[model samples]
Target chain A: MPAGDAFTPDQLYDIERAVRYAEETSGLHFSVYVGGADSETRPFAIELLNELDDPDRTVLVYVDPAGRRLEIVIGELAKRQLSDSSAGLAALTMQTSFATGDLTGGLVTGVQQLGTHAHQPPMLHANDEAHKL
Target chain B: MIVELSGHSLLVFVGIPVLVIAVLTLLVFASSIANGPRYRPGLSWWAPPVWINGPTATKPDPANLPELPELTASTQAPGATATATGVARTLGGASASW
Candidate 1:
């Protein structure tokens, strides 16, 4: 736990657990990056998303503690699944937590919301082929 | 000549060393206290990427992904292409389609 490291082991665990839960519920790829960005936060986040193999299907959460900024960038396909408004709401939730130095709590709640918003119910009529005939 | 060795004098001697010890103790730990929590950058990240309900195997590097077969005109369907799904779509207005 040295200074400038992304997060302490415990902090990382909590964030990862939250991510896991979000991914499970939403069925979307979730990535979290906590560090300072050399450029504008939004574009920097987009760059990070591009670094991933499937940028169009990934949701990346970027936090810049020193700059006191946060960005949640949803990829093209991800944006369709998770709207900007939904992401904004989650951002508000996380902003409150981060302001109070409660990064872990904020992330957990926000990620859960993302997951819930993206949850898709199973299609029950897929196997009813006889009706078509 | 009258000499006084009172309780006040004895208390001073004892209190002075206690204050000195407390100050010294604080000085020893002051650096750690001021530094707060810290993390090193560029090293292996603390936790592995957690992918819930994701592929059971480790996430493959993008560079390592096998090349996909190129779709050529010979194999392409007429006026149809693979559609990307799983993304939510928002429909505007009350337009009905048959």
Candidate 2:
């Protein structure tokens, strides 16, 4: 690993894979930011979320590793799929791992948990006559 | 009087200690090296920020992005949810600290 890099290539791959899995499972955009915030973490995280191409449907995970802070910001539309309580649960998972300095493990686990919480089971035989609403 | 180190003495004293020290060092640092750098609270951050799964493949210029307004008392009112991009947004999120 390089002297100043936040993650090794393997660690980066692990986190990216988790993000991909989350996005695939939830059908929502997932972004992760790891660094300090310019201001209060929440508003700064919100600004970061808004910077996404489709902010209304994205979920942003912002981590201030140095400050030991974490924020999970769900988009207006994405919140429907991922509730605030679910986000809190994911944050708690990350908080525990980060406490032990397992950033990659924390992120991967937390993102995977978020995806599971937001998962919407597929409707079987939606067009069948008996299943019509 | 001249004293010399035979192959047997070198192997017993220098070679074995060096091998054992090397093995111990590897055992101690193997996990951290494999996991890469870690962040300890209260330490100055070392690396620049990393954003994974960026919204776009290409990086957009920050200047073109809209600025978030100063958080005013009124703007934070229960029903005053909106974003800098003119999109009415209600943010749902959770915060945590170690």
Candidate 3:
């Protein structure tokens, strides 16, 4: 934590890097919302997702530090890339860090995990020339 | 032999070491000092919201946007369109608490 923002500039850089890596790995838009929810978080997060450019291809991570709640919302198309079980595992990783008062660490690791899970490697031998080997 | 020092000599010898110790202490705690408060569970948080990797392009406000009734109230209507986009959608997600 810093004077102005919740994180230091270095921490912000780390978080942004994690977000960028996640997006690059998964080919899905990733967004993180950190704050208090006006009311229930899930619906509010869905509303936030709908506000995105492509709601169907996005993953939104909502963290309520004050309320100590974390919600991960995967868009329809994004869900195909990122499974609910994977999201749950990421959430577990974040929860452990967050419970220890490590917000920045939690976010970075969780988002990174999500992105890794969503990654799809190219088919190894889908080419006609591969049979020649 | 016993040695006696003047007040100025004591200031030079004793005060300088004290000053050095103070500076060293400050340097050691500099990072923690720079980073003000830390988030501890069960304690109230005071920072504002931070959105990372958010939308590069903004859209019209919700007031101006059309809504699909199903998404508006999932429990209210069971037979309405299954998604906000008027198509059936399967969403994957997780939730947790600190």
Order the numbered candidates by lDDT, best leading. Answer: 2, 3, 1
- Quote the chain B TM-score of every prediction: 0.32, 0.60, 0.53
Which regions of candidate 1 deviate over 4 angstroms?
A1-6, A131-133, B1-98
Fnat of all models, as shown: 0.04, 0.78, 0.76
Which has the higher lDDT value, candidate number 1 or candidate number 3? 3
For candidate 1, lDDT tens digit of each residue in B35-76?
445422222233322322232345456456665665666665
Among incorrect, acceptable, medium and high, the docking class of model 1 is incorrect
> Could you give the candidate ranking by DockQ, starting with the highest?
2, 3, 1
Candidate No. with top lDDT = 2
**Cα deviation of A53, candidate 3, in Å:** 1.2
Which model, 1 or 2, shows the larger TM-score?
Answer: 2
lDDT accuracy of residue A92 in candidate 2: 95
Kindly report, for each predicted structure in the order presented, the TM-score of its chain A compared with the true chain A.
0.89, 0.93, 0.90
C-alpha lDDT of residue B95 in model 1:
8
- Determine which window of 10 residues in candidate 3 chain A has minimal summed lDDT: A1-10
User: Which ten contiguous residues of candidate 3 chain B have the minimum total lDDT?
Assistant: B76-85
Flag regions of model 2 displaced more than 4 Å: A1-3, A125-133, B1-12, B57-80
lDDT per residue (tens digit) for residues A71-132 in model 3? 99998889888999999999999999999998889999999999999999986766869565
